[model samples]
Target: MTIVLAAAAAALFGCGTFLLLQRQLTRVLVGLALLSHGANLVIILAAGGRGAPTFVGGDEDRALLDPLPQAFVLTAIVITFGVTSFLLALAYRSWLLTGDDEVQDDVEDRLIVTRWSVSEELIDAEEAALAAHAEDVARREMDEEAHR
Candidate 1:
């Protein structure tokens, strides 16, 4: 059923995302595979009901099934396989070089985070100042009205 396939796709995507967030290269590769499978399932589901083949002498009464989704899925499968193999090779190289497949944080990423935090702090301070200024203006207007 469509509902079952949809649920399966959702589950695959959820698990893939969870694994993709892991630091280990193996887990990331597995997650990528799961994500690709989920996508393929979605494409097939979107293709709708099955009908007679588009080949010659096919049933004229029945509708012909669209072959585009199947072609897309096939192309995606090939691409995914290539990417997976390349990543596997990279993981193996990393293991060879470091004796582990765990990815380390980049220095550039840390620097970016530090800069972001500083900017965020500045924004908070600016917001606070604007809020105080608005309050002062409101208070002065109320006082002037009261005096008048």
Candidate 2:
């Protein structure tokens, strides 16, 4: 049973990692789901296979299944569900924003670079205009002073 659990864990981990490395956002979300399931399984296995439910008034000597792991798994499932929902929403928003499905950090990076270049150009243009205006004003002041 331990060997089987270990194999299962390894398989889940490998698949999850593979999916996460994919460029598609959906694949990454799926990978996270797989990883969560793998973690839940690991926790349960660590507590031993589901044997019997825990009871307050039951026989104390009987090997009761660990309720802690079950509780933990339930909590984890809820948390994972919330995260999955959020990821889906984010994916949809990204699609709306970019009209592309595959995850693309590179596109965003390029856009940032382009925007920065435009901003720099605007700043340079404004500075040059301000300097030119200042020079004109200084020349007029000098002419007025000479006449006085």
Candidate 3:
């Protein structure tokens, strides 16, 4: 049934997203696979109920099934397989080099975050100094008026 297929696709997508968020490369690869499968299911579902094959019959009364979704799914499958293979190779290489498939934080990213935090602190300090200076100026102006 359409409902069952939709549910399965939803489950696949949910699981895939969860796995994709993991730091482990292997899990990410599996997640990518699941996501692709879910996408394929969605394409099929969008194609609607099956009818006679587009080229199979000469009868004008029978509706012909649209082949576009099927073609798209096939292309997607090939692309996904290629990407999966590449990821597998990368994961294997990572495991060989580091003895684990877990992805580590990039030094560049950490540096950027550190710099951003420092910049924020500096901005806050500058704003506070400016506010204090403004108050001092206001107080001086009031004192001058009172003396006059």
Ranking by TM-score: 3, 1, 2
TM-score of each: 0.67, 0.64, 0.69
Tens-digit lDDT string for candidate 2 (7-32): 89889988999999998898999999
Could you tell me the TM-score of candidate 1?
A: 0.67
lDDT of 1 by residue, 42-62 (tens): 999877665456655457576
For TM-score, the strongest prediction is: 3
For candidate 3, give the lDDT of residue 122: 62
Question: lDDT at 123 for candidate 1?
Answer: 59
Give the per-residue lDDT digits (tens) of candidate 3, residues 1-148. Answer: 7888899999999999999999999999999899999999999887766455666773667766778989999999999999899999999999998899999876445555566567777656666766786898899999999999
Among the numbered candidates, top lDDT falls to: 1
What's the residue-level lDDT of 89 in candidate 1? 99
Pairs in steric clash, model 2? none
Error of model 3, residue 141, in angstroms: 66
Ranked by TM-score, the better of candidates 1 and 3 is: 3
lDDT of 2 at 102: 86
